[model samples]
Target chain A: MAAEIKAPAYRQFSIAPAIQPGSMADTKTFVANEKIQEAIGFPPALVDDWHDRAIAKMGELLSKYRSFKVYMDACVHCGACSDKCHYFIGTADPKNMPVARQDLMRSVYRRYFTIPGKLFPKLVGARDLTREVLDEWYNYFHQCSECRRCSVFCPYGIDTAEITMAAREILNSIGYGQKYSNEIIGKVHKIGNNLGLPGPALTDTLEGLEEDVKEATGIDVRFPIDVKGAEVLLITPSADFFAEPHIDSLIGYAKVFHAAGISWTLSSKASEAGNFGMFIGNYQQLREIAMRVREAALDLGVKRVVVGECGHAWRVAYSFWNTLTGVGSGAADPYAMQLQKQLDHRYKQPMHICEVTWDLIERKVIRLDKEANDKHIITYHDSCNVARGSGMGDVFGGQFDIPRNIIRAAANNYVEMAEGTTREQTFCCGGGGGLLTDDLLDLRVKGALPRMEALHNVTETHGVNFMATICAICKAQFTKVLPYYGFDRRTVGGVHQLVSNAIRLGDK
Target chain B: MTMTTLFAALFYLAALLFSVGLIYRIRDYARTPAPLVIPTTPAPRTVGGVAMRMAREVFFFESLFKGNLWTWAFGWLFHVGLALVLLRHLRYFIDPVWDWVIFIQPFGIYAGLVMVAGLAGLWARRIFVDRVRFISTPSDHLMLALIIAIALSGLFMKFVSHTDVIAVKNFFIGLLHFNLQALPSDGILYAHLSMIATLMIIFPFSKLLHAPGLFFSPSRNQADNSRDKRHLSAWAAKLESGK
Candidate 1:
């Protein structure tokens, strides 16, 4: 077979491996896990003009949406945010400049959606939208990791990630969409979540996990599937089932559950909770991903649902659950009904992994031997979508301490990058939105630089070996980006790995 | 003997011309608000791309000075020198070059050379690059030409034109002190003094204000994160109403 002219690993999350005595000479070969590739069900390249219809609709929808008005109106354009962008900080490439990325989409939005833009293109400096401009929009918007680091320094708190999402939504409406995003959305619709594992695949995976746990630690760790009357339904990200670093996180959750002696089951129907719709700006898809989890709990009679460590998933689950429940008749939505039935309809239950993890720690349900998990000197990468986009500040009390506490509980030493590096001020890994796919690698790494620099700063002084994060995409991003920038998996992984290792699963 | 009265009359006339020029420029901007905004390099394509693009251009100047290292080096020196020269003139308004004043004055002259070279290169690029020349306004050329003239006159007076430095200083001190002393009677000093007065009056109304306005314009000052959220600009709202 002709060798694939492999693209360079440019962004924060795309995998690049160090040279060693190995069969393959390139880094891409080592990091490309064939199983995870199959797990995502990669789609065929998009057809031309596939997005024209969607873009028109988006032009109309965005024009009407009041929130967009608030967003565009709020920007005074102080230029304070440019240096703060991880991508611009990383590459020093002018195109990679965050403001440049936003301009590609903003000008079009102005041209089509604003009266000032339409009447006097020359006056407002707005240009007519052409096919070439659309292509530029496609290339640049996807490049945004949708990291909200820009918002931290922005005086008005204007978020470009939101604009990227809005643009993707518009693009999707026109049929101009990334196969990676659509394939994931397609999986949620056809199966239950982004990972497209059918009921059988999910059941088999859990069964296999049970065997692995029993072998690794001489304990009967049951990964019950669709078991009725369970108190909790664990909603794992598809990454947990497929992606290696995330899979390790899943094992961590399993061990934590075992040590806590909690009655939890993995529902085959809603095995995955990640919704690419969040990235693409499709609320319907976002609803579907959440609906499956809500339905799985209903179908199995579970009382609570424990979300996995996926950043956007946790964000969508928390922010949109109520809206989805209220939309189209409150009870008509099966997802809301299941939750209402499980929790006595009086109080709305919080849906997030952080909340669940914090609760578990607070309850003192599981005993942790912090020293046993001390192999890694870990630091947390707070996800922008969670920390800034969705008001995650109050959700975890003050700042990034919750994730830190979990790390501290799992290990002896916990470190931080800088004051403005995480939580509300965390730098993006540059692979958010739909930039996680292989196509927008250049833009992604360019955007990952600020966060990478922050990581470098702390890691250099503290001798911190590993970078841990709760967001699945962050893991996917940092895992790929760290190596290219001269860091490794030993330098980055999910927080779940710590929990899994620290949980006393008994002697093997 | 009555040379001080004649010099005072010339200064008033020059100041009036400067005021009229500024008013015309302000009126031009107020009329359209379009010239104030042009399709600059970092035109935002995504919703918040404008903010992000604007931010980089405004603060880091990440777009202008990045990668092209030599241009950045020259540009920085020039801007610093120009600023220092402007500040040093304040010494003329005072009785004498106070303690530590002479130290800055010489440094300013040296820095002025960097600014002159940087501006010359940029002006030259405008003529050389097809795209840049295509966008170049007559005003842009005139502004560059005038700054070069100002810097040259100042340089000539300090180094080449060896005019009566004491007499010129006394003339400036008398003007600020309101005595309006007689002109120094040196052709070079007279030309330099006239040029300095001319430049000051034109400063506020020119594109040079981009130095300050760049910090406020959304096109060059914002980050690109707003695409993740919905942004509805006031202009969009107004456009929707007409629809």
Candidate 2:
């Protein structure tokens, strides 16, 4: 089903394509079956009263999330964010425009919530929530990656991602949920990871990785899991255990911990760092998913919780874990205070692996032989969640700088992509926000256009052979979609993968 | 009913609706719980820094400036000019116009021209730009038209069809003091005042709520110190307690 779709070509400049109305209207993702929905505590199937239920969910969201409430009223339709969305830029679908994507739900919001729409609907572009509109919501809201790129450009900080989250939440409440996000979330709840890898399998994979690393470097670097009293509990995405490029990053983290001599262990209980509850925008589920990590930390008695190279996982860990599960300080609740007292107050709780690696490099605790990566000229792809949604170190924009600093220290030659396509303005890898499943491979390939263009630019200008990122989704998405765009699958990898290539393993 | 009495009644009603409606909407926004810290980073980590960020967004249209130059130029000009024109209009309500208001009288007259020109550019973009045109509803166009119409008519009274300025001032002062004063009988003057009344009455209900909504927007106004300060909302706190 995905093969027939072709990749968009790179132009001389990143220009906005002419509006193609309904170009992507038929591009719908797979819907959650009754079982998948039921697993996640959503309605098993579309309810008879879905129309009313959807509206009620939206009202609940408006009162609960200020982002949803203010964004609904703040948009002036000035089109400042029209061309900012990668999906819109890639597909040229008018509805893919952040403002238009927002209007699908906004129109319904106006009809039900606002006075002007109640009095005169057409004039304000408000419409009743018919089944057709619900289907439209399902199709278009899934099309969004919730990357928050448009929010950066909007005059009022009108985050279309917030609207997308709310729309998905409302859809799920009424028994219309996307299969990819719901299924993974259910897996996280049931088996502690998205890949559903159990404790034995996780242990086997780590032992295998340790053997592979020892064979290469002749050093006894360990991939310890479920080890109680470890100083740090490393919670990473399950992709690292099973997938290419991501596995290489997992190697990097282990080597960093070994060279620095910091006692760290992976927890099978919280094996997965990626949380799809965020993608579906269900706070209860989001908190519930985060609680697994808390449980792991408490049971293991780890002093610090560190997250690995996954974008949204970092966001959930860094920005949300503190509030969601008391991973950080300042929580007055009993559960939070208990966890807080156990954690080392000196270190940032639930720290990014990049922060840990960079701190080691800065302190000269870990030495790197940069010439080991001499064959590859690297560029960093700022993961959308990390770039726009979360921070790394104490400094503002440490998320951007820390990753690049690691790359520069680990690899001698590094180049940045075009200005706007890097840093806070970076494009999404398109497979983020729960669109990483194979069923949406066509949309994934199409949405990769903007970032692919930026990469192509650097390849042409600098002969850049490697694109380093700090996201499992980015690495996975780019690996699969790079071939479609005439680039090598190996072109995209993790920042730690480069660090793994260059870091001095023993007695550094 | 006399023209003076009819306009007086309309202005009072418009004022009442604008004040009450705006207060109600602002209160609703203030009361709503923001469950999590979702500030668009690299955001400021301090409250003062957030205030500075908001100030830049309000005064300089910082995000829009980052977004599109054409939109920012026109939008900023319109807002600044409208502010000057609004301040100038304070001369009507004040018994003895302040020294600064008297000082900026000529600039205020010129600002009216600037405001309309800026609105014209924005309206033209709405009509011409494909993406903008696609997103714009009739209300968007009408919102632009309404403001532009008010600006144009106000400009017309100053430059083209001259009205009795002293009598107009006296009429506004009379309305404030609960006394009736004769309004100047001019077509442009009536058009200008009534359009303003219409704008005020619709301000709280329409997308003009962006003015207050911007202040409440979590992404812009929030400090990015979520790690240091645990921000647990009431509903979310209940969930924790329940657990």
Candidate 3:
């Protein structure tokens, strides 16, 4: 909460944000406490022989994750991905460069794993795994948002996110946990959500939401929790219950579900969709968090599982949950088979809320009034994880189209940011990859520069008042950082917020 | 050892290191487990599509084309020209000059100049561009310089020095037949060969492994089927069994 904006306070707004190299080099996140690490099932404190253990973990990862291993050897330093990182573009720290950041770990990888680094380390840019190297790993690895924008332009598909994850995993293995992400993961394990909000509080919040909706609209709009035999169980980020703008999207989801006449309920046991386990790059922790949803769905007897608008959570739900739990295709796996058998085979295992909304709009299951949002010209900010990591609807690029279609149905005026900044080449909100905490405010502000500049363009040219995104982190980041750049903090809202305001409730 | 014997043994040693070391590195990459599907979308979903993507990346430097144009131009030139030159050199290894090699000889000669041009452009950026310069290490510059030197020396042997082509062919053929023969003694020819030998020795151990690493990269090569198919690594599978 003590986080404040640090900058050339106000950057000269431009269509394309200027690259200020090394602007965020010294930024560091708060270190994790023993309790937070212990809660997430890691070593509670830094070990005496952390260096040895760290190297051993890297060795283990090298064998376990092929992306980490191949990428370690793949970089030719052709400098293709050097300028692709939004952090590097915003902060200008040479280390923020994707290639340079990977070298932080690659150098050490060369030293121990490859033959030449053991012999002539300098000749190949390889270095030993010294204490200084580990410190560099922590600082620069956390600086990366894991946005995967760099991988879009990387000739060899060397995802710095994969490397960043591998580095953080290595750091965590040595008991050097990042406070923000580790603490959030701990809260998630203890209370079933990141904010540590209790079940009774969640119940109260849903009740309040129901009352608020009824007050706003003359009709009774229901927001239910733990209703057995519900066809769909909606798992949203807990921030939807606790935070602003995020709560508005929660309202939107309820409206869409209400109009579509789906029997849906929220589960206190699986109230969270955002998984911080991914931020630390721990598979065990990631699996543990995913299991909550699987268990909740089976217990509640929900045939269809729908994930709410949360970025990396969507990626985890859309991509990893199938294998991590038994949500999707992984039900074919013997362990996953039990849960898979319970899930309705008629629907997509975990449908994205956008996909569900888009489907209803397509089939005329829900009619929407575009005029309700006439006062607002909206532009969609693609959340990096959802844009790059997950797909929507049925096709390959339904991820990009479905949300935009839903927006077009909900609003008359829509404009795209610059071609490169949209779709697969989209920039990070600068607050992703677990750097959304207050300790990294310096970076969070700077990182948002590229994205804010893009948003600034839409406002200037298209009279766009709202920048809608699906991720809670992006909403929180833009809402927080927009004020520093002389824009209203209310400029950022969720994609569903647009849908909520425009849905025609009176019609069949 | 005599000069012919020494050079013959060196080439053999370099070839052995290059092939065996490259195989070991490639094998390591192939064996590593990719636990999740992480293709950078919109990625090809099928095997043929992946091959097409790889082809575009190799032939056109598709991703680099999306990045900086200057980097792409120079990078593409060096790689494509290097391919031509390598193919052109196949004339020396084959018994009778292959018709394709003979046909490409003129273009291959031009490709040597293009290779030098590409290396010069790449090396200049290393010194001039702030971001590129910052990320580049000492070896990065040296790599460009080493390739430039090889290109320049090879060009000299082609146009300026005129090394004994027949003798070069005989020497390689003899070497291929396990019979040592006199190598062309031109200093430029020796310089080109020595640099090439050095490059071969470093291929697997250096960042040059990007050549083989491209094929194994999970992000590029993976199908975006994580939602539709369950991808579990060997270690991850073990975790489930343990659970």
Clashing pairs in 2: none
Task: Give the C-alpha miss distance for residue A243 in model 3, angstroms.
Answer: 1.2
* DockQ of structure 1: 0.03
Candidate 2 lDDT (Cα, whole model)? 0.92
- Order the candidates by DockQ, highest first: 2, 3, 1
lDDT of 2 at B86: 95
Which stretch of 10 consecutive residues in model 3 chain A shows the poorest summed lDDT? A8-17
- In candidate 3, residue A99 scores what lDDT? 88
**Model 1: how large is the Cα RMSD against the reference?**
12.1
lDDT of 3 by residue, B12-78 (tens): 9999999999999888888887887788877776788889988898888888899778899998898
Tens-digit per-residue lDDT, A274-336, candidate 1: 767677665556655666766666688866666778777665654455444321113433433
Give residue B120's lDDT in candidate 2 (0 to 100): 95
lDDT of 1 at B187: 68
Backbone N/Cα/C clashes per model: 80, 0, 4
TM-score of chain B of each: 0.66, 0.98, 0.97
Residue A262 displacement in candidate 3 (angstroms): 1.1
The stretch of ten residues in a row with the least summed lDDT in candidate 1 chain B is B33-42
Evaluated against the true chain A, what TM-score does chain A of model 3 have? Answer: 0.96
- CAPRI-wise, candidate 3 is medium
